[model samples]
Target: MYYVIRYGPAEDNSADLYMDPIPGKKVSFTRGERLGTLPLLTFRKRAGDRGAFLDYLGSSPPCMVVSDRFVEALRSVGVDNVDFYPAQLVDEATGKATPGYQAANVVGLIACVDAAKSVYTLMPGLPEGGAIPKNGIFEFKSMHLDYTKVHGAKIFRLFETTSTIIVHESVRDAIEKAGLRGIRLIPAEGLDAFY
Candidate 1:
């Protein structure tokens, strides 16, 4: 199984675990409609747009426990056994629960990630729609990254508690700083498949 970590919006307690739009304000993507509505640009990375990235995080956070994108990214590449966590959970840093529908601090999110069970898989070539295999162990060079700078720190911390399967030395080294173990480094290229 592939484990992924995702944060919830700091909104009120009544919002869906994924912080889905309040009915009418929902936006849909070409692949499909996510439970939560985010601008298309939110998924695509922009050069040196850290503030924009941060603003997106500030407003939407990431209700990943129920995110279709999170699951689909892995699933599309034949890594279908994916799961997400840290939903409506209390923040360890703060003595209070995450803001239900309001807003939350980044530190609280860090705490939630530290307490979740996320799966990180390192693969070389990502699978395409027609050429996916049913089941087997495959290896390739690391080419892409599953998490962005905004996502890596928050989620990679959980690698400390789980037995993750990594195939790239650089990727392993990157996450090692976050305190990860159970590593099984292999040969691979970019992880573009997860995108």
Candidate 2:
């Protein structure tokens, strides 16, 4: 159930990819590096970072989920704002995407479901909300996991949350690999043209 969310250079000026988007950015500190690493399917949480291993790492405050190792790793790598609340908030919402919805967009929160599993997940996500762009997520090849085979293509409700992310489920296999190509611009940085 581990996943990676990374920020990459935008091929075009469609979406402005800012640094912090996931609540994890505000907590884990290492989250950005973790997400930026490529081939996420093979990514794993840093050793001693799991909830049960905290004691061996150090005596963290009850409120601190961000581990010392995580912070050091992020700092060493020059990345700040690794948060953990984004994933937890998804659970707080009880499988409905909203609690972690990004505010700027009406419905920024989403539940990315892997249709094969028939359930939404919180493990893998876009590191910075801006990398995901405010719109045109489906423009490129991304696996859309819809157990119900939702008919409304590129249309759905985005949940609401202060600690939010635009959750989307794809059947493509972690994510749909549409293959990088060209760019197209539109209001809200629409998907690259002919993606």
Worst 10 residues of 1 by lDDT: 106-115
Off by over 4 Å in 1: 1-17, 22-169, 180-195
Residue lDDT tens for model 1, 1-195: 122322222331122222434435543221111234222222222233222111112124332222333233333334322222222323233323432222221111111211112223333465433322322113222332333322333222222112112222333344335332222233222322232
- Residue 37's lDDT in candidate 2: 26
Mind sharing the TM-score for model 1? 0.20
- Per lDDT, the best of the predicted structures is 1
Q: Against the true structure, candidate 1 has what lDDT?
A: 0.26
In Å, residue 53's CA in model 2 sits off its true spot by: 45
Per-residue error at 106 for model 2, in Å? 3.2
Model 2 weakest 10-residue run by lDDT: 53-62
List per-prediction Cα lDDT, in the order shown: 0.26, 0.24
Query: Can you write out model 2's per-residue Cα lDDT over 16-86, one digit (the tens) per residue?
Result: 11122333333222111233321101111222332221211111111222223333433343332333332
